[model samples]
Target: MEATQQGADVFFVLMGAILVFAMHAGFAFLEVGTVRHKNQVNALVKIIVDFAISTLAYFFVGYSVAYGVDFLVSAAVLDGSAEGSPFAKQGFDLVKFFFLLTFAAAIPAIISGGIAERAKFWSQAMATAVIVGLIYPFYEGIVWGGNFGLQDWLSESYGAAFNDFAGSIVVHAVGGWIALGAVVLLGQRKGRYTSDGRVVGVPPSSIPWLALGSWLLCVGWFGFNVMSAQSVEGVSGLVAMNSLLAMVGGILVALIVGKNDPGFIHNGALAGLVAVCAGSNVMHPIGSLLVGGAAGAIFVIFFNLCQNRWRIDDVLGVWPLHGLCGLWGGIACGIFGQEALGGLGGVAFMSQLIGSLAGAAYALAGGFAVYGALKLLVGIRLTPEEEAQGADLSIHKIGANPESEMAPR
Candidate 1:
């Protein structure tokens, strides 16, 4: 029975890892559909390559920083058969690492959307290494790994440890806020705004591709939320239901608020999912719906504000979709997870508020520190000529549709 239970847990986490890993493709295609045709290939390449670099960084350093576990031991020891091994039986620990690695890799995937058109490829690659290896894990350790006693402090002072059932603040909010710094530092994409400050729309390249990406993420998010339990016995149907309700709520609200704009509609779904991630396990379905609706509205409002009013030129509106909505989710979890709100209580509002804000501030600083140094030392943006030519030809030396590009002019 013990061996059987261990194997089941291993299989469960491995499947979750595979599901979350597939979300990287969703990230790629989402960016591909949003950026212009000239830069679509770069968007795809960046996500995949960033994942590769994130894997190396996390495997070597980030995981240890977060969890204080290292894979420096032999394979046999890692498999947990060796005497005195800390690893769980049937290699559950290894699969857990795989699951968590997928989450770690999402930081760059989130940032890729914000800096899509203007970021230098190699500089972004270096940024990915530093972020996944150090910046992200430092906070991750504090919240999830209990590295700095912040969780204990929160629990003692506020009546609960900061609760993020998934990673509303840890992954999405942090990634989004960090992207804000990079976007601000890189400045607007050339021609995105005129000298007089009028907004020039750069429309999406493909709506079908964008919708497909949203669909893929929606499907995979079941695993992202449910499998966060990390054990079959710990799984809850409440999580699955909350995720579904929130996704639909986001879509409906986005459709209404965005006036049926397909881009807003698709991204609205993402906003809801991002917000509900923190409270899915505890919130009532109605609370999740309200949370999702609020997230959709937040995304539409802030996305426009960032682009037109603020003139930030965050290409995919990542700072709004992930950052602001994620912050709301972290705070909302505290409200909607309380028994007074028809939730499974044990969460503290102040803890969630402070923890979420702390995450945002840390990521913002890290972004400026990493991207700022790179800008000073090596530069993080493409030259104006490179920007006009698009990242595909400028960085990769090829177009996404090469045959079409080669057709007789």
Candidate 2:
């Protein structure tokens, strides 16, 4: 029975790892569909390459920073059974590392969208290494790994630890906030803003591709949230139900608020899914619905604000979709996850607010610091001529649609 249980848990998380791995494709296609035709190939290449780099960074360094476990021992000693402990079972720790690595890789994926059009390929690659290896895992250690005893301090002071069941603040918020710094430092894409203050809209190239990206992300998110249970016995139907309700709520509200624009409709689904991630295990379905609805509306409102009013030039509106919605999810966990508000309780409003605010501040600082250093040391953006040519031809020497490149004029 003991061996059987260990095997089952291994299979469960391994499958979750595969599912989350598929979400990287979702990230790639979403950026592919959003950026112009000339830059689509770069979008696809960036996500896959960043995933590889993140794997190296996390396996060698980031995982230890977060969890204090190293894969430096031999294969036999690395197995949990060698130590007479469950953690040594079937090399489950290795598979668990695979699962968590997917999340770590998402930081660069989120930033990729924000600085899509003009970011230097090598500079962003260096940024990915620093972020996955240092900036992101530092916080992951605090919240999930018990590194600094921050959770202990929060629990003692407020009667509850920061209750992020699936990392609304940790993964999504951190990624988005970091991207904001990179975007500001990179500045607007060429011709995105006129000197006289006229705003030019750079619309998505392929809605079908964009919709496909949204669909893949929605499907994979089930694993992202539910498999966070990490064990079959720990799994809850509540998490699944809450994720569903929130996704639909985001879609419906975005459809209404965005006036039936397909871009808003698809991204709205992402908004809700993003928002409900933190409280999915604890909130009632209705509460999840409200949270999702608010997230959907927030994405639409703030996406416009960032692009038009603020002229921030976030390519996929990542700061709004992931950063802002992730913030709302963090705070909403305290509100809707409470017993008084029809939730499972054991959450404090003040605790949630404090943790959420700290996450934003920490991410903002990390973002500016990392990108700022890169800006001074190696430069972070493509030159204006390279930007005019698009990243595909300039960086990769290929186009997403090669047939057009080969066609006679």
TM-score of each: 0.99, 0.98
lDDT of 1 by residue, 1-409 (tens): 8888888889999999999999999999999999999999999999999999999999999999999999999988899999989988779999999999999999999999999999999999999999999999999999999987999999999999999999999999999999999999999999988988688999999999988888888888889999999998898999999999999999999999999999999999999999999999999999999999999999999999999899998999999999999999999999999999999999999999999999999999998999999999999999999999999999999999888889697
Cα lDDT for residue 323, candidate 1 = 94
Please give the CA lDDT of all the candidate structures. 0.95, 0.93
Worst 10 residues of 1 by lDDT: 400-409
Global lDDT of model 1: 0.95
Give model 2's clash tally: 3
Per-prediction RMSD in angstroms? 0.9, 1.2
lDDT of 2 by residue, 108-141 (tens): 9989999998999999999999999999999999
Clashing pairs in 2: 80-88, 80-89, 81-88
List where candidate 2 sits over 4 angstroms from the true fold: 83-86
The per-residue C-alpha lDDT of model 1 at residue 262 equals 99
Minimal lDDT window, size 10, model 2? 79-88
Candidate 2: what lDDT? 0.93
